[model samples]
Target chain A: DVKVTQSSRYLVKRTGEKVFLECVQDMDHENMFWYRQDPGLGLRLIYFSYDVKMKEKGDIPEGYSVSREKKERFSLILESASTNQTSMYLCASILGGRNTGELFFGEGSRLTVL
Target chain B: AQSVTQLDSHVSVSEGTPVLLRCNYSSSYSPSLFWYVQHPNKGLQLLLKYTSAATLVKGINGFEAEFKKSETSFHLTKPSAHMSDAAEYFCVVRFSGNTPLVFGKGTRLSVIA
Candidate 1:
């Protein structure tokens, strides 16, 4: 069974504080992603990393950043958390080649910024 | 650009009734299609996938989806709705290369007793 682990199940941060959400995949998948889920809008991709030290911006990457220092780990960063940044964050991963579009997802981290 | 469209925002059905969730996609080439279910406060789970193999794809938990190239549609269906089947469904599309999935807004399914 493939397992994607998220470091935090829930988090609360104050405005202007720096926030970090960590994710690790035991499957050693080469591709990792960060997405913020909101009501009605659904899951919007924030950033994705296809390789260590390589990252790409997704549709909704404006208020977020990501780090992939290791093949099995990816981290999402909120430089300065704000109330509007409150949302459920999801981490996902897929094998590098010919993965057939199958994505394994983590349990998700719900963050609330006050 | 690849895109996915989930036709309904919500669908309600009683247990033992049929279930249908409509989805459509637009892609420049033959696309990889998937249906994912997300329970409340949980992560997304893959229900089924269509990758140009068989038109009809059977998935976990007695669910299936048919890929129609002519209509550019991939609709999920189940014979009977179960209480556990009540979850949010997302239609997803992935074009060739290393691109990630393009997800629809999702359709919420509610199962009534």
Candidate 2:
């Protein structure tokens, strides 16, 4: 079974603090994604990395950045956390194949900004 | 560009009753459609997907969706609702060949005893 693990399941951070959310997949997938889910808005993509050291901005990428240093790990960085940034963060990975669209998602990290 | 729209924000059904969640999409190319379920405080789980192989797709947990090109809709359905089926359901569409999926607002399913 494929497993995607997030570093933290729940996190609380103060305003203006820098925060890091880590995600690691054991399946050796080549594509990793970061998304923030909000109530009534669904999951909006923040960043996606198709390969190591390669990244692309998604629809809502402001105030967020991502790092993919290795094949199995992807990290989401919040430069300066704010109250409005509080939301559930999700990480997903997909194998590099014809069906690169099917994603295996982590449990998710719920962040609360104060 | 691609987008998806879930017509209903919420749907309530009794156990053993049929379940239906409507979703519409817009894409320049033939798109791959997917239905995912997200339980409270959990990540999204893939329910089913349609990639033009078959119009009617069957997914896990007895759920299925039919892709209609005329209506540009992919609505999920099930014969009977289970208490475990109560969750937030999202309709997703991704254009072929490496494009990220676009998700609908999602429909919350509530199963009543």
Candidate 3:
């Protein structure tokens, strides 16, 4: 079975503090993504990495950045956390193949900014 | 560019009753559509996908969705609602190859006993 593991399931951070959410997939997938979930707004993509060292901004990339220095691992960075940034963060990975778009997701990390 | 819209924000049904969640999308070309379910505090799980193959697609946990190109709709349905089926459902789309998915403002399903 494919497993996507998130380093932190829950965390609390002070405003203006730097926050990091780490994700790792064991399936050797080539595509990784970061998304933030908010009520009534659904899950909005923050960033995605198709390959090591290559990243793309998604619909809601503001105040967030991502790092993919290695294959199997992706990290989401909140440079300066704020109260509005408090939400559940999800990480997902997909195998890059012809016509394959199924995303395997992690258990999600819930962050509270105070 | 591609976008998805879930018409209803919430739907309530009794256990053993039918379930329906409406979704529509806009894409410049033929799109790949998907339905995902997210339980409270859990990550999104793919329920089904429609990639221009069979218009009607069956998914896990007795769920299904029919893709209608004329209406640009891909609505999810189930024969009967289960208590375990209560969750947030998102309709997603990826316009072209290798593009990230665009998600709709999910529909929350509540199952009543």
Candidate 4:
């Protein structure tokens, strides 16, 4: 089974603090993504990395950045946490190829900024 | 640009009642379609997918979805609703491997006993 592991299931951070949310997938898929989920708004993509050291901004990339130093790992970084940034973060990975496949997701990390 | 539309924001059904969640998409070319379920405090799970090989696709937890190109719709259905069925359901569309998956706003299902 493909397992996507999130380093933190829950986190609480103060305003102006830097936050890091890590995700690792054992599947070694070439494509990895970070998404922010909120009530009513649903899931919005933040960033996606198709290859190591290569990243693309998504619809809601503001206030967030990502790092993909390794093929199996992707990290979401919040430069300065704020109340508005409090939301559930999700990580997903899919194989890069001609076939469009469903993504394998992590357990998710819920962050609260105060 | 391709997009997915989930008709209802929320749907309530009595236990043992039939379930129907409407979804529609707009795309110039044939795209891969999927239905994903997210339980409270949990990650998303793929319920089913429609890639054009089969119009009617069966999925986990007795959930199924039918892809109708004529209506540009892929509606999820279940014979009966259970309490465990309560979750947020998202309709996703992927134009190709190069494109990001487009997710609908999602429909929250509430099952009443």
**Cα distance off (Å), candidate 1, residue A75:** 0.9
**Candidate 3 C-alpha lDDT tens digits along A8-85:** 999999999999899999988888899988889988999998889999999889999999999999999999999999
Q: How would you encode candidate 4's per-residue C-alpha lDDT over A1-114 as one tens digit per residue? A: 779999999999999999999999998688999988899998899999988998999998999999999999999999999999999999988878668777899988999999
TM-scores of the candidates in the order shown: 0.96, 0.94, 0.94, 0.96
Determine the TM-score of chain B of model 1.
0.96
For model 3, state the Cα shift of residue A110 in Å.
0.7
Q: What fraction of correct interface contacts does each candidate retain?
A: 0.53, 0.42, 0.58, 0.66
Candidate 3: what lDDT? 0.90
Among all windows of 10 consecutive residues in model 1 chain B, the one with the lowest summed lDDT is B93-102
Pairs with backbone N, CA or C atoms under 3 Å apart (clashes), candidate 3: none
List model 3 lDDT by residue over B14-113, tens digit each. Answer: 9999999999999446788899998886678899998778999999999999999889999999999999999999998877666777889999999999
For candidate 2, give the lDDT.
0.90
Cα error of candidate 2 at position B75, Å: 0.7
Report the lDDT tens digits of candidate 1 across residue range A1-114.
Answer: 879999999999999999999999998788888988899988888999888999999998887889898999999999999999999999999877655658889999999999
For candidate 2, what's the TM-score of chain A, rounded to 2 decimals? 0.96
Off by over 4 Å in 4: none
CAPRI-style quality class for the chain A–B interface of candidate 2: medium
For residues A61-112, what per-residue lDDT tens digits would candidate 2 score against the true structure? Answer: 9999899999999999999999999999999887654564577899999999
Candidate 2 chain A lDDT trough over 10 residues, lowest sum:
A94-103
Q: What is the C-alpha lDDT of each candidate?
A: 0.90, 0.90, 0.90, 0.91
Q: What is every candidate's C-alpha DockQ against the true complex, given to 2 decimals?
A: 0.67, 0.58, 0.65, 0.74
Candidate 1 C-alpha error for residue B1, in Å? 3.4
Clashing pairs in 1: none
